[model samples]
Target: MILTAPVSMFAMLMTYSSNGSSSRPWVTPLVLFSLPLLFASLALRRAIPALKRSPQGSGDRSAAAVALCLGGLVYALALGPALDNVGVL
Candidate 1:
């Protein structure tokens, strides 16, 4: 959900801004939606083996390299505040 997470977040932000509402129940689904991406990342690490490597590696899993890290960071940053807002953190 490297693409899906942020796109969904941007869409929600745009919707909320237009309506001028400070509240957003729409954001909660993004967290739930991220589960599949998380599992897929883990599965990729296990199946590919190369994806878990360091800079010393010769063979790299190029496709997953940036997207996984970037996606996880974005998901965490967005999810943390959302959870805290709902008193779930």
Candidate 2:
């Protein structure tokens, strides 16, 4: 999950940079990608205890998923200036 977040953020940044002719085109994709992560994170938070009780690798999986979602959000906000500089709305 952590890996995917950075990749998604990078993809968003690239999308913003490459689509210079459009205004705010990045918003749709950003929201689209983010919404799922947001909901997944909420669900994870709710399921943590149940997940912790699960055998094997469930706990690690949950942690990684949470990390990825958070990292993606952080990257999106952190990379905003680059996006705007590249012509994002």
Among these predicted structures, which one has the highest TM-score? 1
Q: Give the per-residue lDDT of model 1 (tens digit) for 1-89.
A: 55566767776775576656647664645544566557656755653555666454444566556556756665676667667767797
lDDT digits (tens) for residues 1-89 of candidate 2: 44456766666575565545545455534544564556655665655665556566766666756765665675666467447656664
Candidate 2 regions with alpha-carbon error over 4 angstroms = 1-57
Query: Model 2: number of clashes?
Result: 0
C-alpha-based local distance difference test score of model 2 = 0.58
CA-lDDT, candidates in order: 0.61, 0.58
Model 1 C-alpha lDDT versus the unseen true structure:
0.61
